[model samples]
Target chain A: MNQIAETLASEHIHRDEVGAKIGMWLFLFTELILFGGMFLAYAVYRFSYRDYFALASKELDVFIGLINTLILLTSSLTMAMSITALRRGNKKLSLIFLSSTIIFALLFLVNKYFEWSAKFNHGLFPGSNDLLSLPRGEIIYFGLYYVMTGLHAVHVIIGMIILLFMLFYIKSNKVNQDYYIMLENSGLYWHLVDIIWIFLFPLFYLIH
Target chain B: MEHKNNHIVGYGTYIFVWLTLVTLTALTVTVASFDLGGFSIVVALIIASVKALLVMLIFMHLKFDDKIFRIFVAVAFLTLMIFIVLTFSDYSFIR
Candidate 1:
């Protein structure tokens, strides 16, 4: 009887969809607060060395930052559209949108690469001689800049991998209208990355 | 108890929000070029908040999802704000 019961438990069993969402949101809360601590550190340091921060922030390339902002925002739109497409039973369109989202993610990373390389060429790294000789505030500014943006870029990479898996899932018909939480959760994570960049952009690159 | 919600957002709405976000990005860049004294950071942060709200509400589908989802998001932001305010007290007093 026990063996029969084990066999009866199929993968199509009733799953608590709502509970899954709640759990995702709860995990997101922890992620949000984790970044909150970094923002707090940024605030304290910026407050302490207002002049140094102004000078250091001006060295950042707003143009590249602007481009990446648009890329991420557009990716968010594409990711959202992918969800809608999948739900509408158009796997082709869903995969296309997911591909676009991943491409945008790559574009953002490429821009970041050039941005960081330029800073490296100029010796703006945290403990480099140029930065070391600068005011403590400027050093702290670059330090925070590297740490925050580095961590955010890591999130972008993770998000892209998740979307890639999502694309495979959609192609396999494993994600349908009746069971698309995987897609939805990935969308949530992507948007969170975009939102964090939305705040990070103006704070680091825009404020003159 | 498998539950699925398919909130079909109009293509037009996503395009509209996209346009608005791009416009706001332009506005923030333009505003930063001007010297707003102490109000500069405040303005930038406000615009950032608005953009974040749009992504959360529409893109993330929190607007159409369960109200509890929204409530939890609200609580998270509120908790962050409380921490901010508490830190403000420390900074204000010490500095």
Candidate 2:
């Protein structure tokens, strides 16, 4: 009787593990579609006013963009390391790496704030501003600019919140070598966010 | 617990991925600075694709996962690209 009960409990845990993995993948698919729409809009506007887009992109601070790119890329490295730690049964190192990933993500956001505010102060916002004094085409370019990067920033915020939750989960012992799906899934989402910025950096800040 | 497979990610792999990403970023920025005419976007997108592969494979561990999951990811991405391209064609060629 005792052996049967133990077997039943183990089976239940295995079922939950599978469920978590599938659930996370489904959530990731939703994110893919969400970002997919924004990419489509960016492509349309960029193609419509290619020259104006190039001119507007030059106004962006490439230095800040480059810095943010490096920051996010570093965060991704830490995130991957965190997952590796979890899989290897090193809970303390996993938590440390996870904390660093969150810190780097926050740094990325702070840099973005300054970059966006600088543009705002310069009157580069949509719907008529001093920065739009160039031409009508450039004005429309700034509009798309705010919309795309603004949306990307929002995603970064969401990713940060998710990472925070995962961190707490680790601390609470909900995640360990036996079960690290949360870390894996969050890592995937974080990587996607980084990949988006990989494209955004050049699109918004590198045109000559 | 049944350990079906154990695939560890080494530190060298991490460094290699990061190097590839930085190199690609530099290339993209340099290409964008030149007057490549219509080829600029093409080159940018190609570089972005390579970066995406590195992240998906190395960071996300898709390379070590089940084949089914990989197939699903590939199909999803291909479908998304096709949809975007078809929609863009409508706007690009229209009067």
Give me the candidate number with maximum lDDT. Answer: 1
- Chain A TM-score of prediction number 1: 0.93
Local accuracy of candidate 2 as per-residue lDDT tens digits, A141-179: 777678777878898899999999999999897766756
Assess the local accuracy of residue B64 in candidate 1 as a C-alpha lDDT between 0 and 100.
86
Full-model lDDT, candidate 2: 0.81
lDDT of 1 by residue, A1-208 (tens): 5355435644547567788888888988898999999999999888888888999898999999999999999999999999888878788998999999999999999999999999999988878899899988888899999999999999999999999999888888778655688898899899999999999999999766
Model 2: residues with Cα > 4 Å off, grouped in runs? A1-19, A131-134, B1-5
- The number of the candidate with the highest DockQ is 1
Query: What value does DockQ give for candidate 2?
Result: 0.58
Residue A197's lDDT within candidate 1 is 99
Which regions of candidate 1 are displaced past 4 Å? A1-12, B1-3
Best by TM-score: 1
Query: For every candidate, what is the interface RMSD in angstroms?
Result: 1.1, 2.0
lDDT of 1 by residue, B1-95 (tens): 32456568977888899999999999999999999987999999999999999999899888888788888999999999999889977896884
Where is model 2 chain A poorest over a 10-residue stretch in terms of lDDT? A13-22
